[model samples]
Target: MEKIAPVRLSVLGHPQRLAVFRLLMRRFPDRIPATELAQALNVKPNTLSNYVSALMQVGLLTQERIGTSLRYGIDMQSARETFDYLLLDCCRGRPELCAPTSNFDLNNKASKKYNVLFLCTGNSARSIFAEAILRQEAGDRFNAYSAGTTPRAGLNPFALEVLQQKGHDISVLRAKNVSEFQAESAPQFDFVFTVCNQAANEDCPAWAGQPVSAHWGMPDPVKAEGTDAQKSLAFQQTYGALRNRIRVFASLPLGSLDRISLQSTLDDIGQLENGVSA
Candidate 1:
């Protein structure tokens, strides 16, 4: 094997590169586009390009071509190897002195269950997809719900079709107004996420528990002007985006992060451009 330890360490030595690597690691399995990364880091394009190229060249980052965009993610195995190298022989033959990676699980049952609410202009496509995906992925750790400023008469047919086709239960899904959740007896949300630009920018009723909020704006698949197949593709893309975002959200150490840090992290996730196209 090549002696990549030095190369990996060198790649991570720069502050900007390290920050980029850490950000990618936060999204782990999800690939983040260059534009999102640039925005998150608040760095110029050339600077980010250099940092990204260095990380990829050293196997610390991996990039995949999705349509016309290049999405980047951390090389998890390589990252683990780097950690292993850093900790090697540091415990004086005492395993307890070193942190055990085997016991770490993001989906541990002992973690606190958070109630999450997703909102949009209409309880039709994006919000519904987010609710279903979050419930399916981390239902044990999160109570996922969806509402809209103005709900449609019924759930979007395309949304239902996509959820069902992906093996998600849609029987319990319904299009409901945001006012329903604002009632006195409604569940107090721990986090409220707006999934559409319209809902994000509009005035919303005060949620119980004073939930932390973020805007994950996505293009409305319902507004997609194309053939049935193209519209289906749009819905599928939205599903992928929401699923990826939820996965990252579910993996967060909610109990460990304080309100400010958690809020910042949530906002960063919202900035991701995973499935914005439609």
Candidate 2:
């Protein structure tokens, strides 16, 4: 732990390297393509390659080829170990110092209600599932909204089916254009999340409120292939994935968390691999 922790810290010591790591953390579980990562960091491809290599050498990042381009994602196992080392070994019995502190001024009205917006490319499946799940699970605590970058003609039938099976009211669910929420008349969002890779990568509309944003990208169940039962199973899995995430989000002590800590928690939530884990 001692050796690995210091090495990880040294690699992240460089400003550009740290920025790269932070961006990956915010987009956890969604591997960003090489070109997109470079553009997002405003770093040259060659330089970014070296930075990525440094992180990979220390086991802080993982790389894979999705088609023709290389994609990068955080190595969650390494990250957890590094964090555990810091909290367990460095705290010297003063664990309170490591705990997240409250910043009441950031979200002072968390005790009341929070408006959350979930986004995706089609708004027909993943985003719809997220909206419905949060509404059903935490309706009193959060107002759930969803929209698409380029909405489809209607909601995905399988999504509606799964929601109906789960006893959710599907009457209010529809594929909405993101512009609807960007309008001056829309409610001020406290949290904005992109639930699919396409929406997360796209240039999104500017929200009126300075909402905390994160990428919680998941596989699109709508694109599932095979028999009808298989396709329906995909939708059910998507619903389960969103439900697990929403439940964890709803259970957070929002009233006590600072903005930074809240952001971290949201990012960690994104690291959930599927419908499993906290």
Candidate 3:
């Protein structure tokens, strides 16, 4: 029997490296200043310089200097190819396996479209963004919705602005509690992602069907403060992170693999970014 090796994208152990990589991958084609990244992660300049140097050394990041400022970004095309290599083993010289691996029924599933629910505690920033991000990112793939276990009175306005800046029309977004989707009355869900630390630890709504659940806890961007520019920057930052993950999710192979293999693919999709990690 031939055993297939699992995909490996970024070096996974250190949370700091993951943070920097996630930031870099969050916005492709647009360079983020190293100074800004250091501030965002609450690290020192010298320490962040070392991280950038290491990532560039490993071909996971690229840096350019303009005057006194240094900007860093992923070489998105190559970065995504690196991730594709891990999953499809294409760079290992097997082009055949790299082709689309289908598992889901897109045509016949008109009657059975998968639903996804994103849960958080506040329903203000992170969960709201995830709902918009997934809808815009995977519009045809799944029906994505968001609700907080402890719902806020209204959706975060910054979240709305972030979605608008990303070119998504989200006039229909609103905040509601998780009681809206309880087991006895909830719509069946195929996946559930909890995006807040509070909600992940709380007793969650009992999903009607067994959904593939996970957590992608992000710091509350709204909780961050400063000038309007500073707060807006925070929303843009968090929006970029969630958007990257959802992009990877939308590109997944959907027609050829068995259900078990497809589930593995979905799990990997969340862990791996569509670009370089460092």
How does each model score on TM-score?
0.60, 0.69, 0.56
Each prediction's number of clashing residue pairs: 0, 0, 9
| TM-score computed on alpha carbons, candidate 3 | 0.56
**What does each candidate score in C-alpha RMSD?**
11.1, 7.2, 10.9
What would the per-residue lDDT of candidate 2 be over residues 1-278, giving only the tens digit for each residue? Answer: 78889999999999999888877876776788999888877789999999999999999999999789999999999998988888888886466889555332445764577889999999999999999999999999899999999999999988888989999999999899999998889988888999987677554555664687888878889889999999999999888888998898989988788777998888888888785674
Report the Cα lDDT for residue 186, model 2: 91
Indicate the worst ten consecutive residues by lDDT in candidate 1: 101-110
Candidate 3 global CA lDDT score:
0.69
Off by over 4 Å in 3: 1-112, 254-276
Error of model 3, residue 194, in angstroms: 0.8
Query: Which ten-residue region of model 3 has the weakest summed lDDT?
Result: 1-10
Cα error, residue 204 of model 3, in Å, equals 2.1
The candidate maximizing lDDT is 2
**Model 2, C-alpha of 196: deviation from truth (Å):** 0.2
TM-score of 2: 0.69
Task: Give model 1's TM-score versus the native structure.
Answer: 0.60
Q: lDDT of all predictions, in order shown?
A: 0.81, 0.86, 0.69
Per-residue lDDT, model 2, residue 126, is 95
